[model samples]
Every structure is written in C-alpha cells, then in structure tokens.
Target: MRAPHTATTLGSAAPARDGPAQQVARFGRHVAEMCAVMCVTLILTGLAVTAAAAALGTSNPITGAPAATAAVATLALAASMTAWMRYRAMDWRPTLEMAGSTIAAGAVMLTGYAAGVVPADALVGGTCGLACVAMVAVMLFRFRLYASHAHHAPSGH
Candidate 1:
C-alpha cells in the first residue's frame, strides 16, 4: 500500500532559515554597530586634533580651522575604512580604491600648496572635499557590486 501523505511529502513544510523580518533585523543591527564604530572614531579624532592644536600653540580660531579640517577629513577616511571592513570583510579592491584616492588627494593638495595655487589656509578644505568625493565614489561602486550580486544570486538564495 502507498504511504500516507504528510506535510513534508506534500512540499508544504516551513523553511528552516530565518524569515525576511529576521534578516532585516540582523542587517539593522550590523548597520548600528558600524555607526557606533564611526561615532567612536570621530570622537577620538576630535580629541586628538584638540590636543595637537593645544600643543602646537595654534588653538586660535584662525589657525585651528585648517587643522580641524584636516582632522575631519582623516577621520572620515578612517570611518569609511571601518565601514568597508564591517561590510566587505577585508576585500582588497575597496581598500585599494580608498588608498589611491587619499594619495591622489594628498598629492594634489601638496602640489597646490607648493605652487601657491591654493592658499595655505584653503589646503585643508580642498583636501577634505577631495576625500569626501572619493569616499562617495567608493560607496557608489560598492552599492553597484552589491546590486549586481543580488540580482545574479540563485533564486533559492
């Protein structure tokens, strides 16, 4: 005699994996952790800048602006690296992109400083702007990679 049909045999069993809600919650948690890292990095960077300014006798508003700008840019780059590590998990491409961008920005800034194309006071702002642009580009590239992967992943996934 044929075996009696069961839910499993009928292909109606529930999935063993977490549902979409759980997946979203986990993603949210990861984002929160990354944000926490960014916050800490920013705070530490600010403290370091403040200390350095005090030590250099440049704590006055006029001189401090450039230092502050440089510090903010460096901290932003650090935060981007942190996010890349958390999300991409040691992927070299993004790291290389970041490094290349930073170096290029520095070179440009130095060249401008030497040529007097950019005033000393404006160097920090230019560097910060370049770094920010580079970071945004990297972020866009990462998003594209993720989108393509998601699109190509097997339906079962």
Candidate 2:
C-alpha cells in the first residue's frame, strides 16, 4: 500500500548522484556570483558615499561627509547580505543576526563620525568592507557544508 521509491522521492541526493565534477562546477558558479555581488556592492557604496558627500557640499568630502554616507553603505550592505542568503537558500536567522549587527556597528560608526572620533571615509569604507568580508565568509562556510554533504551522500544510481 506504499508508493515505490523514485528519483523525485529521494530528494536532493537523487540529483547529486551526478558526481563531484558537477558539484564543483555548481560551487564555482556560486563563487563567481558571490564575487561579482561583492564587487558591485563595494563599488556602488563608494559611489553613493562620494555623491552624497558632494551633494552635501562637504569641504573635505573624505573626512567631512556626514554619517549619512555610513548609513547608505549600511543599507547597501544589508541588501547584499539578504541577496547572498537568498541565493544560498539559507535560513533567515543568520541573515537577521548579521543585519542587526551591521546596523548596530553602523550606528556606532556614525556616532563616532559625528563625535569627530572617526573619519567619514573610515566609517563608510570600513563598514562596507567588513560587511562584504562577512558575507563572503558566510558563503564559503555554506559551500563547505554543502560540499561535505555531497561527499557523504549515497549515490542514487
């Protein structure tokens, strides 16, 4: 009275039987995409900060821009983090935690910038860089887990 086991019923392990080469290629594509996202996020954050500083008429744009630049970079980084999580099909817990931490850090940096304790460029650049690095680290960790799973999974055939 039970249904027979089929490829579809076997879940992901069914498709993964294709072998390691396919798995590596899939991971490679993910790595490439992650790199591209990071690059674009950094570039866009820099441009946004520069434009914000210019628009605000900061005398020494690099060091004189308002905390707004940091805020903008934080927004961009949050978006990137969300995208990375979605692409990896990860749970939202880490994404939420990362977003919270990023926002908190950004707030601290903005406060420091406002208090003249840190340069605007440092605040914006450091926050953006840190966020991107964290994202890449998360992606790498996920990939390692995936690879390990694939390695241990039983061959469907």
Candidate 3:
C-alpha cells in the first residue's frame, strides 16, 4: 500500500498549502482594487457628462440631475463591483472590455453635446449617466465571477 503523503512539495522542500484566512485576504484585496477602479471610472463619467452638457448649453439637461446621479452611481458601482469581485468571481476580460466601452461612451456623449444634438434635459444626461452606471455594473459582475476561482494552485514539484 502506498503511504499517504503529508507534506507535498512541488519543487522545494516546503509543504504546499493555504489557509482560509489567506484566501479571504486575497479576495478582499481584489475587491478593494475593483472598487477603486469603479469609483474612479464613475467620477470620470460624471465629469465627462458635465463637460458635455456645458458644451451643449442646456439649462435643464434633466435639471442637472445626471450630474448628481453620476456621482452616486460611481460610488454604488464601486461598492457593488467590490462585493461582486469578492463573492461572485470573474476574469480580467470584463474589466478590459468595460474600460474600452467607457471611453467610447464618454466620447459619444461628448461629441453629441459638441454637435448640438443632445439636449440639456434629463434625457441625454440621464441616459449617459445611466449608461456609465450600467457599464460599471457589468464590470463588477464580470470581475466577481472571475475572482471566485482558486488562483494559487499548489506548485507540484
């Protein structure tokens, strides 16, 4: 009968193992990073909307509601993303995709405002703000899905 190995070493003499605490810590760190990214992206989105509205010269612009909405959305996105990244699990692909989409969306809003197409009402502002929020939400869910995977596999010696 083969003896059950206890200290399984991959390449070195050290035994390969990990405790729940370590896993929790790693998850926490990843969550924090995701949240930070979401927050920053949200802030940028709001700024972009404001700048775009200013270019359009709309006094109502949804009564400037989107400006505030963007601010709150960013925060919510950050928190949600963090939790999702930690508990749901996802991959980096979603994050990259979101980054690209965010840039494109911002550009579109800016162009619309510059071209005098978007009105300064809640319609445009709200739409853009909502879009940004949606993007962040997607990012959060995607990352969460990836983060759930066990990353540090025991290096088999």
Listed in order, each prediction's TM-score against the native is 0.51, 0.54, 0.39
Ranking by lDDT: 2, 1, 3
Write one digit per residue (lDDT tens) for candidate 3, span 16-106.
Answer: 5545665456556665565566656556655766577778785533466643443444344545543443343333445345544544554
Candidate 1: where is the Cα deviation over 4 Å? 1-43, 60-90, 141-143, 146-157
**RMSD of each predicted structure:** 10.4, 8.3, 11.2
Q: lDDT (0-100) at residue 141 of candidate 3?
A: 65
> Which pairs clash inside model 2?
none
**Residue 50 error, candidate 2, Å:** 3.6
lDDT tens per residue, model 2, 1-157: 2232223334455532436786567667655765576568868777766776678776555566546666776877677866775555544665565566567667777777778887755887776666656655655666654333322222222
After aligning candidate 3 to the native by TM-score, how far in Å is the CA of 28 from where it should be?
0.4
Stronger candidate by TM-score (2 vs 3): 2
lDDT of 1 at 136: 54
The true-structure Cα RMSD of candidate 2 reads 8.3
Residue 127's lDDT in candidate 2 = 69
